[model samples]
Target chain A: MSTKRDKVIVCRCEDVTLHQVDEAIARGHRDLESLKRYTGFGTGFCQGKQCVALCARLLVERGGDPPTKPITPRPPIRPIALADLARLVDDGDGP
Target chain B: MTEELTQPFDAIPDACDVLVVGAGIMGLATAYNLARMGAGRIVIVDRSYLCSGASGRNGGGVRAQFSSETNIELMKRSLELCDDFATEMGINVWLRRDGYLFLARNAKRRAELEASVALQRSHGLPTRMIGPSEILSIVPEIDVSGIEAGSYNPDDAVVFPWPFVWGYARACQRLGVTVHPFVDAELEATGGAMSGALLRSQRVESLGQEKHIRAPLVILATGAWSPEVAAPLGLELPNHPHRHEICSTEPLKPFLGPLVADLESGLYFSQSMRGEIVGGVSNARVPPGVDQRSSLRFLGLYAKALTRTMPILGSVRVLRQWAGCYDLTPDGSPIIGRVDSLEGLILLCGFMGHGFMIAPIIGLLTARYLLKNEERELFHRWSLGRFERGELLPESMILG
Candidate 1:
């Protein structure tokens, strides 16, 4: 089932391919939201950081009903590791 | 790698009145409220620093004017909270009530704006439809070449995101709440109910050693990190973190006052107090997934869209360009309140991109829900379980 054409980039950060997302979609998951849960599209090092909009477009093209409304934007644009983040405050970064 | 939940430590004390996971604004805000209500021994553990999530990196637009009555009420109440936030929280939050101007360039969009304005006015929001001639008169800097009509809400405004987080964090600290940065919480569930959480932090300085925290009541305000945190517990939160690229141009003369959102190109911009035009454009390539790398294409798109909206901005040199991920939910509205299956896990996430503006109200609402079962229908409708019930929140006022 993991063929060349099926190898879509599910997550750009981790580079998990399309077969992952397609397999997830084929497994009773008819929506991009569910496909993301099964295929790990949004769960990545970047934390779905750059993949959501692309996934929306892909879902729309793949006949999966796109969200009637536009996707919402959450916080923490950059995913800084716990250690680096803690140090910022110690180094006077509370602003 | 973190180990899966296999055994609960018998020796370590594993209970807290309230355990706040993810030290973002919502978590901190809720924790502060819990602390105020005498929820003693409150501990807030974050896998990262405060505002290291979307709270710090957002457009920071606060307005009472919304297309829907529910959102308008929520924002109106939220605006009141934000107005006195500095004195209430004893932190100087640089909130400027510069007003928000949503400009429509076509007849259809103009009609939509008129309807939204009527809705806003019906709900006591100071908004009205203005002709292109009036639009030009209000903000003369904005070129009205292709603009047909626009919706102007003078009550919408912007603020610095950093201070707001600081306000909540300081308030929480003053209320005797313990905040541990860089501590990751490993959530465990039994029979579909969250039993407890195991928090591990190796950078503790108190004893110059590692530290661990255990709590029963945990709130997940991790924003984009919610999915990863939920994975260990076999729970799924359908929130996607999409990287949104934005930029700032060199400090120009003070020309624009209100936040300008072009409904056509998904471009939103406002001149910061420093005179730099700070805003972003919704790129066409951004799909529903995760990637936070910066791109030159975003800068180009912003320049083109800005020039199209206002011709005078065409010659302004860009100062810098950056990108951040927006933790988006399936529906546009935020997933606030408790996760039903989890005994103590409350979700204050999926604000999409509007968390900063609504943080004050969300903080109060999430806190009240935790303290008492009493809550508005808005919270009930926006629960994380709403998706499982096939109920989706439909919000139309989406900006870049």
Candidate 2:
């Protein structure tokens, strides 16, 4: 919990830093969902794969959670083109 | 962080003055206001965590631009309350009053908008009808090629929806009201009145064991899940939970002036505080449920509609897409106040897609009604009994 590690980037997809995550936690966003939202961590290009665990661990470090529960995972876990996804559904193919 | 916020939740009480079901914005707002007015021993229980329902899953658009007088007046007050929310609740909701620009793609829709704008203007709302050329100046980000006319209101705004739930719940908790999350409630009616509910924990330690709690008054803020609570009681509250979906693109330069909506397709988009172009389109083709999953159908519809309206956003990559339920009553308006025969059970639901927008004023008014028995005409007009009497003032300005 040193200030030296404060600026370390946790969510590369959104460029959310560890300091930002800790700050959100300190401001009463104890749950992973609110933390994910307030810090914009797990909602970036990686869709939480890169930063969810880090943020969850940080929540535990701040004495919060059943840390296993992360934010809700949505479709197309990897980034996909909007045109391509539209085409995929139009062609009768979907997840 | 304060000591009270991170502190562990207190145990559920066996009895309370008011039992509020669903800890979403409506319930929390109502509960917080009631507790503030010295309504004793308020307890709120939800099946999921905060922001887990329609309250959290909305576009957070608060506007007074509506065709009806009641809708316009309620939203006008809701906007002011939102302006003072941060100071009063001690949480920054990140409210941005960039305004809402509604576009009409054809002559028919343009005429409809013109009439609505006139109605809005008569109520002292600053809504103005504009041409496509003026629409370009409002939001150059949108391509106004097919747009015939537009409705521009500078007061309509957007906010980060999560903080409203958290702020209200925290305020309630600080006022000695226990706002329990991850807990389920089964409505219990005895003799005639509601006798509170049977609570069961949904967490790992204590799960599915019901505990009886007694209270004379119970409020159902259950939103789309009200049918389940109503069915066993033999009360016919007809509605369906339409799953509405939304998506956000990667952050870009913040250029969009207002939340833009296509009056024809019900397609709407706005730039978030973080600069992501977040948007959604109207879709009711799917089945109704609280746990409706996201579908490729939503992405397809939204992408086509959004791209067709704003060609510049065709290549913008979608970072996330999710779905939530819109609690649609038989009539478009919300069903508030009391239900007949169900003496102690009150209904504060069916606000449709604009519940989050109007919840603040409704919550304040609902709390006043409970405290002093003050009768709001909206409570009577928006009651479930109207459906039986054929007195439906169905609202027309609903969006996804």
Best model per lDDT = 2
TM-score of each: 0.75, 0.93
lDDT of 2 by residue, B78-123 (tens): 9999999999988989899988898888888888889999999888
- For model 2, the stretches where C-alpha displacement exceeds 4 angstroms are A15-31, A60-63, A67-70, A83-95, B1-10
* Candidate 2 vs. true structure, TM-score: 0.93
RMSD of 2: 2.7
- Model 1 chain B is weakest, by summed lDDT over 10 consecutive residues, at B2-11
Give lDDT tens digits, candidate 1, residues B235-348: 788887878877665566887878889867778998877576788877657655556556655666666667657776666666445566777887788887767777777778
Docking class of 1: incorrect
Residue-level lDDT tens digits of model 1 in A1-95:
45785666757765767666554444333345445534546544455657877776766666554554433332335432222222222222111
Q: What is the number of residue pairs that collide in model 1?
A: 37
Check candidate 2 and list the clashing pairs. Answer: B334-B350
What TM-score, to 2 decimal places, does chain A of model 2 have?
Answer: 0.80
Clash count, candidate 2: 1
